[model samples]
Target: MFCGGYQVQGTIFLNPNCDPMMDAQLIGGALQGFGCDKDVLIDILTQRSSAQRIMIAEAYGSLYGRNLLEDLRENLDGHFKEVMVGLMYSPPAYDAHELWHAMKGAGTDENCLIDILASRTTSDIFQLKEVYLMQYGNNLDQDIYSETSGHFRDALINLAQGVREEGYADPGMAAQDAMVLWEACQRRTGEHKNMMQMMLCNKSHQQLWMVFQEFQNISGQDIATAIEECYDGYFQQLLLAIVSCVRDKPSYFAYRLYSAIHDFGFHNKTIIRTIVARSEIDLFTIRQRYKERYGKSLFHDLKNFASGHYEKALLAICASDGQDF
Candidate 1:
């Protein structure tokens, strides 16, 4: 159920009984009243798949002669608006916007950069780059290079190339790669960074899994532990993200969701981004993983952490899995 490291199981799917014009009519009514009917917005937008949402957007413009996203911006505000607008974009377009937001302005959001680049598949990255260029009028890789420096920048650029090996993994090569990684960790020299980066960034996820297993056998520690011991700063974080996604992408994202909710006063952007981005991909899997890893359903945690229309919209996208709110 996985394609190129992305799980095919998604909470949101194409609505079999879809009527774009009717849905657009309801959405237009929701936008027309004195106070926007956020309930209607949540119900209509959250229930439709991304492709369906696009159709609805087209229908809205045809019926109302107004852009859906711009209307949402004019009518809605705050994090709720962010979520609504985010749902309007295709996955790659959304990712491109997120990347541009992360890199632009006074400081870089290293975590955002790491989360997106490390998690996307090669095809996703390629589409994202193309969209970024068309939308932002700049190259994503060049922008990332300019925003970052040293080993971290090099690693990000390497990932941005979107040329990681795919489809086949050799046990023999995995063992060799593992040994090379172990030796790099032991050496802890400038050259060691290159060695680790090459192996981690270039190998397919399946091959990396084998390499990680071989690494555990060769050394008494996991690859993550080895990376932690040898490196520090954003460079270390990016490597760990790659390994984490390779091992179990859903689990990695589940942990990210947990941290976003608990690590601070509510890292709402990360919360919204993770849920909305994965909703149509593997959010159901992420939700299951969240409960398994954290001993509580994602819906339960979000209900506790958030309130009002924002919470309702997020829960709607999360969909139901027999979890009582």
Candidate 2:
């Protein structure tokens, strides 16, 4: 149900029986924002299933005078814009979010860069870079260069430029790498770094899990244990979350936030800041998972840790979304 975040109602799809091209014409007219039928727009677009949305988008392109994407841009803003963009643009939203995370911090979120750039399809990612350039008016590579330095930055930037294979990762090969990482960790050798940097950098959580299980069987050590022995601080936390995301992301993040607050004494500013930033993305799904695992609402947990306008802002974004503003 929850692909990444945001609650999706399955009925919001296009009518399977409807003529898709005609549907696009009607839908695009409603979404036009120039005295368009807001009621019709809301009824049709809001109820559209993901597949329907995709069809409508296609129809808008094929049958309409203008792009549906351009129309959405004219009307939607903030969080609503994000939701519309996610459904309209598809996988690029994931890359956009990844780029957002990579650029948001005081320093670059290189982990995000490595994970997203190396894992995504080259064509999709290349298009995403162009979108970033068009939207932000600065080259994505230039931004990456500004955020980091040296070989690590170059490696990340190179990946972002999409010179690598187009999602050409082999699951069988990944499984072998996972085993290498586990074995190298046991050997107390530098090779562990290479294996982990590769595995954690690319590879989906699902693929990683398969490889991880194989790695564990071959070497009696879980990915978490390997990370603990090999890395530290935020990188360590990121790796642990990546490994656990396959199983239970909500619990993993909840555990991390709790530990950071209770044991490490992270300031309220830091806690609220991180939670607020992620609320629009990971927090929605994380909340669902947190509720399932701990029988407590994420909103409630967040309230316990935060207060005042900051709390309201985070809660508001999570509940009603940012577009309501």
Candidate 3:
């Protein structure tokens, strides 16, 4: 259920009575004149699904002869603007944009690269590659290569290939793979990177889960613990992310949400990106996992850390329907 690629466990869904033109008109009214109606923007955009939002964006462009993203860029500011603009794009385009922003500028956001490349499904990665190429006129793998180096770059490029095995997971092969991983963890040499990369990048998530279980039996250590002890820096984080996602993606994202809130004050960008990106994917499960893992609701934490329309928009996307808490 949590394997991604149309297995949606999200808080938002397609509105049954959605009207693109009407939504566009309402957005136009909110954005017109001196001060924007932040409440209207939040209400309409947060309620609609990503597909519906796309239709609304198309309708806005046709109705007003203006680009919705650009108009939003002009009208909104700060994190709220970022969230609204993020909502306007189709998911692939938004992901491409986020990846671009992460790699652009002086220092690379390795966390962003790991978060996306490690977690997205194969089909999602393929669409992201196309969108990245079309929107930025650059190959995503090439961009990643140019920005990163060593084993970290190697892991990212491999994931970017979007060729991970899918469908039935063979238990026997998983046991063999687990032995190979155990050997790699024991050696911790240059070839260790290659072995780990091959198993982590190529195996299906289900197979990887079995491998992790086998690995624990073989080494008396969780795969995550082995990763932490054997590797360091970005490569370590990326490997950990892949394993965590394979085990429980929603729980992985819940930890991310918790980190975004608590790590060195408020990581607004991470908060916005994670919530928006996962809003239509598995944020419902993430909310439940957050409470289970941290003994508090994600909404409660967000309410404590954020305020105003920005907070309202996030809460709307992460709302629990009165049951998750």
Candidate 4:
């Protein structure tokens, strides 16, 4: 999601509600500010959608607002800079490619690979793979295999392939996949752990939800129990989060915000990146759904779960209700 919604709907919606003309003016104003301010950049570009960023880029020349890309070139640094600049100029696909390049060859930059690959939508990953090959002359899986090792590599590769298409899958076929998942979970079988990793990262929320529902009914045990029975560490938590999210997404964010604050003991950089990426899109609905389901707002939960500046930023994002049109 974009910059999490703010305290005021008036500021977020304004008159234009992402009016490109207004976006153009805002970009110029920021670029021409007293000096390059990162706070300004994060404040403006982080909040605006890609279409608005494009308009600002296009109008920059006429307005002499400093070419958006050039300004970013001058101002930003490191991985955030790369992701933001790529997002500013092109679609999300190229940023995924940038992430791939950072990881591929030699020792493999696991951090970069996980950062982009872990949180993307299936369609986004699909498009990323297509563009990655076009840009790099190699497949994503091949590059991953070259860099990674063991079951972790295998699992990561499967996920990067985007094999779990979310829609129009035959329920019959999906039942079979669910059976495979369930049997893997059976303590007698011992296939549960590896399968857990595969499912958690690979399955889409919709496809996996079907699997989760049937597995619980058929196995007579809930999905969380199955996951707890099978896996551990961040991956287990991720699977649990997935199941929780399928039941209700806002609950998932609440859990995540809680884990970030109280459970994990801090705002992990990975969680931060993931939340920032998502807050622009699904987060608004997640907040609404959280309120509807929990009878307490997502923002309120963050206030309880987190503290300090971290709390302030996340709470602001929650209040903004990032999903609003």
Candidate 5:
């Protein structure tokens, strides 16, 4: 989730000898109350990794002869319900579901699309594309093509191809790529969108980091700043996301989390999706980055911005100290 294991410090981890039936009972006992044991629910759900949660779900269903996810939805409410259910899905499956939600809505969520596509690694994208096809019986590429248009659509298609060049980077080539990027944005204007997109999307993170540095050396402006000055609209946002992910993904997601739920009329769905999706990944680093940047705890902010089970669920996931709940 944060630069292909470049940042391995995360909030969630495998609980040793995690027993699924024990988890089932813990959850079952929690739900066996008049008011739904919110604390117990948060404790159980937030502490387990995704694999453990899946096993717990299976155990719960087998024990009670009821679908665990359905029961979760029936028992929980609002943004909390979405978070719990989203946590139940496997990572690739959950990402595919998020992409489907983004494109299926009345107006496409271009931010969600760009966020998922631009931030993911080549291998992750490959797995997500496969999951999307198997789960929905539709090609991810075709769905993206139909849902979007113009240079942004073309850029997304390139990303969905899952064809990034990986492994060691050539420094000389990185410098050349940087020069080409500078020329495209500065001298030639928007005449080389495809070249820029290909370089941004296809190169390995190590390669792009070099290219971005050289780009700044040559142009006297960061790649993101140059892209902002030269490009506009969805394409510019996509390019910026790519640059941000390559540079510092945890910080990027921290900022994204802030935007999703910070303002008046917050998007709780985005909050649920992002926090749930990232909980088992680099959410720990993201939380630290958020606190450093915003001068307050992410948990405190979520508690203020949201209410009821939703706030509790998010705090459980955020888990200020990055320890198991």
Candidate 6:
């Protein structure tokens, strides 16, 4: 089953039988009576399921008279802190936090915006909006409006509304939408921006995947290729993100991990966010896809890019067996 863009098989399922109170005690002990036991923090936080983590948080608060999140924040520093805290948040809250940060800076992080907003389902967006509001005290759509503009802004706004079509896809409608996409993108000298955005934003992922197939058959061009040819800048990026997410989100995120890790500059923020966000969702499948496509272990690459506590923490979460890497 698809949880928005993430596949169920892609998730890391651990802590099947767990004691949250015991976990809370252990975690509390790790944080106290030492100069912050990094190993214990890495092991416990990264091994447990997200649900278990929530329980641990509650137990930690009751047991220690301190919030688990605040204790982790004080004990850990740098990227290690980031990954641990990210794991503690519910999925929607995490996404909201990410979006808030993306738009908080002087210049908007278009890639972050596109990566998140375009790929999520209507239901995912609805949940995200609620969390975003609670976390940031601003509407998600209004934040988008403030941070972005033009066709790209419009697409983001449409996605933020969380009003996309859901349920079974119609083959006939898929074909018709494909033609509509082709005409909007390929035939005209100047692309029909409104029509393209409307259809792409409105259609369900199932329908969009079929539309992409029909588009490939009709235009002899993959949807991403066509979008690349017709549009430029953030608009093209968003369109490609939508198509990629619809067709294969794991592959899409796998490529993202590859780019972030392989580059000299090393998009650390993107790397940390992607791994932490997708850890419970599809990081395993992403790891498999990454290995298959790149002919290297993501774990090996991770070591090259990060080190010490940060590397240890990241590898712990990423390990297939939920062991420290």
* TM-scores for every predicted model: 0.96, 0.52, 0.96, 0.66, 0.92, 0.93
Please give the distance, in angstroms, between residue 150's alpha carbon in candidate 1 and its true position after superposition: 1.5
Give candidate 3's TM-score: 0.96
Candidate 6, residue 34: the lDDT equals 54
In the predicted model 3, the residue pairs found to clash are none
lDDT by residue (tens digit), candidate 5, 1-325: 4354565456777878678999898888877667688787788878889999999999998888888888888888777778888988989999999999889858899998998998887888999999999989989999999999988998999999988887768998988999889878866344588888888888988899999889888878988989998889999999999999888888888888888876636887777877888877788888888889998878777877888877877877787345532
lDDT (10s digit) by residue, model 2, range 162-218: 654323446777667766777656664445544555555456555665677787777
Model 5 has an lDDT value of 0.84
**Model 6 lDDT tens row, 230-257:** 8999988898888888878888988888
Query: Which residue segments of model 1 deviate by more than 4 Å?
Result: 3-8, 320-325
RMSD of 5: 2.4
61, model 5: CA deviation in Å? 2.3
Which prediction has the highest lDDT against the true structure?
A: 1
lDDT of each: 0.90, 0.57, 0.89, 0.58, 0.84, 0.84
lDDT of 3 by residue, 91-194 (tens): 88989999999999899988889999999989999999999999999999999999999999999999999999976589888789999999999898888888
TM-score of 1: 0.96
For lDDT, candidate 1 versus 2, the one ahead is 1
Compare candidates 2 and 6 on TM-score and give the better one: 6
Residue 150, candidate 4: alpha-carbon lDDT:
58
Per-residue lDDT of 99-149 in model 1, one digit per residue for the tens?
999999899999899999999989999999999999999999899989999
Query: 205-241 in candidate 4: lDDT tens per residue?
Result: 6676677777877888887897787766544554565
